[model samples]
Target: MATQYANDIPFSASHDQQAFKLLELPPELLSLLESEHPPTLTITSSKATETTSGYALLCHGDKKYQMRQKNTSNPIMILAPSRTMPTESDDAETFISSPSVTTISKIEDTIELILQEAEVKAAPKNKWHEKFAKSRAEKKK
Candidate 1:
């Protein structure tokens, strides 16, 4: 049982093998899965060869949101925190965490930074400055 948070990355509940094969799981998710105390509920799974856009799993205490296209589905599902039910004032105007562009962008940026760190750690000899130096040398040549 993992502590699900708001604005967390959403995951698709796919059971198809093809979906997982095509879905690009962010490095962060990979890292989480590898962690010793990974959150069981936050784990993502897919079924189709490719992932679908505009979908995520909203998990609260016991509520699970299943938003998907019944016809053609993809595996690029996200694991996000559950949102409160919409109210009259919140209808189409209020800004809550759901399938939104801003939230997605933030998640992507965080993933990129995690990946950069991982790369740097994996390649101790090739620092960012050293890579820049190599590029400069090649350009000069």
Candidate 2:
């Protein structure tokens, strides 16, 4: 009876086809799918080689996606979020909470202070000497 039940279920190539489909998807499409499903995602790439390089697989939501790059030079692709400046008419002030806004402002002020300190510390004390030495060396060459 158990053997009969096992035989009753027919194996289909759908899963294999699905796996193949997953491999061919781009990172953008994979990210969109991951955002929608919120599944565990894993990315793997082939080791540096002549022909096998630039091939990467993204595994997520029980599906695998394959991506091939035009060249093997760039092993990793990074997608950065786009930043937009808020206009006067923008309703971001209304949408964002006060606490969050305050936190963001504080962070920005801290970063600005750190950058100012870095710039002050990085200023060359012997700027004239360094520039004159470089120019003298170039004239000699």
Candidate 3:
């Protein structure tokens, strides 16, 4: 059976997703995860086998891991794994997992590509009129 690692923690404002940071994984997994194609995250959920409650999952590293979210006093350090557990276990648990390197890098690249395109499209049309106006006003003051 394929293993899984996942967490359902809610994302916070400080969750700064960036591309270069995504490279910090095992090189082969990193290469596999970050394709030039659009990346997609597959989330799954199901009812607990015994209880009426349910759990959520996010897949990374060819494994499916459970997930959860926590509210903390600090803002910047939000969305940490509730707990880190090795794959060997009997009962079910909840926690957050890091994004796979491929997922992270692909996302980062897509965002950068979009931003670059936007900058190119907007740069010439605006002609820096607003920027120049602000600069002239500042000089006068």
Alpha-carbon local distance difference test for all models: 0.41, 0.41, 0.41
User: Candidate 1: minimum summed lDDT over ten consecutive residues — where?
Assistant: 105-114
Q: Cα RMSD for candidate 3?
A: 22.2
How does residue 95 of candidate 3 score in lDDT? 47
Ranking by TM-score: 3, 2, 1
Give the clashing residue pairs of candidate 2, or none.
22-64, 22-65, 23-65, 23-66
Per-residue C-alpha lDDT of model 1 across residues 6-91, encoded as one tens digit per residue = 44654433243221222234555557657998656432332243555433442323433333323233224344344444557675
lDDT tens readout by residue for model 3, 4-86: 53434333332354433111233443465677752354557744656557666544434544454433343332133333333
Q: lDDT value for candidate 1?
A: 0.41
Local lDDT at 4 for model 1: 64
For candidate 3, the TM-score is 0.26
